[model samples]
Target: MRNALLAISLIAVFAFFLYVAVNPGDFGGNTGDHLIFGEPKYSDMDDYFIHNGQNQTGANNIVTSIVFDYRGFDTLGEASVLFTAVLGVGVALRLLRRDKNDE
Candidate 1:
């Protein structure tokens, strides 16, 4: 069980790295704070797919499909991470609270 858990952890890490390497976070160009990310002239191909996606490809909720399809595994991992963080926060909050009598 321990080995299985460790292997999965490693695989998840590797998969994250592999996806990042393939999908350039910025297409070797400027993706700065000033950019709105969907400006027609400045946008990357990904932005085009996201903006005009639903109409172009006849798919509804383009953002949802993008989040779960092309980047499905990554998004899943990120969601798992957020869930773990929230769970930890809840557990910590519960532990930190004092009972009325204790206080």
Candidate 2:
């Protein structure tokens, strides 16, 4: 019964996502912009990055320039979080092994 309920719940969640993807405007999407999938949204920030990211960051790759220069602190925080998670997992594994050996 639990497995059946889980299956039904998963199916319902997937259907909800599918509905949202098909009719995004129904769920707080901008009705004024009729751009479909794969269409680019032109913004001043995007224009600035495309034109001046290389000059500002001195990086050949625009993506690298944006990640390392524009969002450096945000990237650093992400790396810190990932490092913490890895350290936690290592500590947990060591504790588990020590406990098993103590038995």
Candidate 3:
């Protein structure tokens, strides 16, 4: 229970960083009309698909390709960041790497 709370708190801190990512000009005090987060408006590329045994490229599924291949570097970075955070928590809580020779 305590560990879950700690994890949630850490994630909240990271999510709050989005304040810096979203410009004030983007929101402009209009709070009720649209979403504040995510892909900025769900572009067309998000809905692309395939045909008989081959996928179409004229519509050029940039978003799909990015999430799967070209942007995989970023994905790997995100995974590493999560791993680092969990490892940090484990160390902080003394859940791992304890010195066996110590009292």
Candidate 4:
């Protein structure tokens, strides 16, 4: 009975997510408006980045300028997360090896 209840709840949650994914509402716009899937919404920020990114960052490549200068903090956070995951896996492997040697 508990397993059946859990399965039903999971299915409900999945359905909710699927519905949301299919019908994502327009961002920063009026209610009841929907955005087409995979279509990018143009904003002032995008225009500014395209026009001024290279001048501001002195990077020849726009993508490099955005990643290294415009979004530095976000890039840092991603690198930190990747480092932490690698450290965690290394520690887990060491602990498992130590347990094997003890037996």
Global local distance difference test of model 2: 0.89
Off by over 4 Å in 3: 1-64, 95-103
The better-scoring model by lDDT among 2 and 3 is 2
The models' CA-based lDDT, in order, is 0.76, 0.89, 0.63, 0.88
What tens-digit string does per-residue lDDT give for candidate 1 at 13-95?
Answer: 99999998998565445466554355445558767787777865566887776776657799989999999999999987786
- RMSD in Å for model 1: 12.4
Model 4 lDDT tens row, 40-96: 667899889899988799999888998999889999999999999999999999998
Candidate 3, 1-103: lDDT as tens digits: 9789989999998877776666445643445756665336655554533331124333355556555565678998999999999999988668434653354
Assess candidate 4 and give its lDDT: 0.88
lDDT of 1 at 92: 71
Q: Candidate 4: which pairs clash?
A: none
Candidate 3: which pairs clash? Answer: none
Model 3 shows how many backbone clashes? 0
Clashes of each: 0, 0, 0, 0
Clashes of 4: 0
Q: Model 3 lDDT vs. the true structure? A: 0.63
The TM-score values for the models, in the order shown, are 0.41, 0.63, 0.37, 0.64
Q: What is the Cα-based TM-score of model 3?
A: 0.37
Evaluated against the true structure, the overall lDDT of model 1 is 0.76
Best candidate according to lDDT? 2
Evaluation by TM-score, superior candidate among 1 and 4: 4
Clashes of 2: 0
